[model samples]
Target: MNQTIHKSQEKNMILERTVSADSPRQDELVPSRYALKVGEIDVMVISDGVLPLPTKMLGHNADSATRAAWFSDMFLPADAFDWALNAVVVRSGGKTILIDAGLGSDPDLHLPRAGQLIKRLESAGIDLASVTDVVLTHMHMDHVGGLLVDGVKDRLRPDLQIHVAAAEVKFWEAPDFTRTDMPQGFPDALRAAATRFTREYRNNLRQFDNEHEVAPGVVVCRTGGHTPGHSVVRLSSGGEALTFAGDAVFTVGFDHPDWHNGFEHDPEEAARVRVRLLRQLAETGEMLVATHMPFPSIGRVGIDGDTFRWVPAFWDY
Candidate 1:
């Protein structure tokens, strides 16, 4: 009996050591999720992955010197900067709404570092089936890519109702959408993805024209510029409000809203929209959640004389 007891204790010790060895480290890059209470609603900010853009592709009108100076001011190298792909999950009105599904399941399409949205969602304890609504800010691949699962079109959360700008849907779905005015393969890719979205979510897709309430406290505001149908989502309750500024204002653009970017479908119009939204948010003192901002992507805009500044949300913990 003494020998048997000794063996059992030894086995238990081994099990404990094994469990300790497998424990996640503090430095590990686990699922990045943040939760905030927007009045009576619960909002979750999650990351799909970070995307690295070549320096030449940034700040369309800004000269190299200006770009370098801006990066230096922030104590960050211009060449090392990346775009954080953020998606939001909102639990309100007895519904689970996901805004901007991330880079999908394949890492090869845009950046190999991305395509972690589904995994991150799972890690965040969010069931894919529980996502009752998907409000896309635009049809950009990065935003809509996660609609797919394992490279199969519309396989990820297919049952969820998708809401998009009516103009955006029509633009991408037009038979003549193969025009070469845009990037070489952009029109084709957009059309293909839009086609799949149309087919798969035909019964579940919802399109809106102007400012319309999508949920009890969520409204889709038309803030065109990045894309014709690109819009921002506004959530409000009891006078407290937050706006998900989907790609309207980028990192540097916060200070230089006039310095248009190369990726904008209409740079001039995009700049106008961005400046207007920035000023409005700053004046209203409301929180702004940007998709391409830093990891948490939750921040606020402050008007600085004629320009604006970004104030990233402080860690509550």
Candidate 2:
């Protein structure tokens, strides 16, 4: 009986290996996307993979000892960190809206793990042609690079409308990076990506001033902190609401809301925006999602003494 069981186990292992080898991409070990509902609106959060960045990028203004202590407390590596890249898709009023695209290919940057948005969307059965609109949080490469990926334009509908803030377009016209503290080679890459995206999709842009309602109960509002035109998408229906905060909030913002992130063009104003948004979400008890938060990124904010707390929603599986 023991010999028979061992042989069966070996046979099963061999079969599994064969299947994985035949369809490597389809056999992901972990889930890459999550789906949920906000009242009547259907929402899905897809993971575009992760970006490994230096630890200092978390808070350039913070002292090394303080940053080290925070990292120790969180049990994270002291030298580097992996930032989650998340994009959202919403369906409302018969309109399909893509909140933000993920990082596309950039070999020069040496970030190979990212740029999975296109494949993941396809795996989720979301055809590019089916996307009726795209609402950008900002013109950052990670947010707009997916659209600029080769052949993505050909797949998308010719009449598809891309919603962005007027300030974002104007800022990128002659972008000012005096305040940003990005790593070397980032600013140039960002500038090139933004310029190419704007030039290629000039006619499809539907620039708005402050706020615009793309569909029923779906509103995109400019917050202007991370970038001049940075915005967040708010979905409301059946008395429930959820906000898709672009770069307004990061994972570390909960404990250190005043810390200056390296990517913020105006760090001071960005801090103010983070604090205000967290306070509002805490007071109203509404669900919040952000681009850099962990996958699914669905949760509520609670006031924890002087700082805020992230209450991750329990999986409804």
lDDT of 1 at 1: 100
Candidate 2 local lDDT, 1-317, one digit each (tens)? 99999999999999999977654364465567899999999999998888999889889999999999999999999999889999999999999999999988873899988888999898788999999999999999999999989999999999999999999999999999898888899999999999999999999999999999999999999999999999999999999999999999988899999999989999999999999999999999999999999888999999987699999998886
Enumerate residue pairs that collide in model 1.
Answer: none
For each candidate, give its TM-score against the true structure: 0.85, 0.93
Give the Å shift of residue 111 in candidate 2.
0.5
Cα lDDT, all candidates: 0.79, 0.92
- In terms of TM-score, the best-performing candidate is 2
lDDT, candidate 2, equals 0.92
In candidate 1, what residue range of length 10 has the lowest lDDT sum?
Answer: 175-184
Residue 73 lDDT in candidate 1: 87
* Residue 231 CA displacement from its true place in model 2, Å: 0.1
lDDT of 1 by residue, 1-317 (tens): 99999999999999989867764345434548899988987899988778777554457577889888888888977675677889999988998999998867543445677767887787678888788888999887778878755553344466667889888887676644321233345556656766776776678778899777778999887777888899999999877889998888788887788876656777888889998999999999899998888878788888888799888888775
Cα RMSD, each candidate: 5.3, 2.7
Candidate 1 residue spans exceeding 4 A from truth: 1-31, 107-110, 151-159, 174-191
The TM-score measured for candidate 2 stands at: 0.93
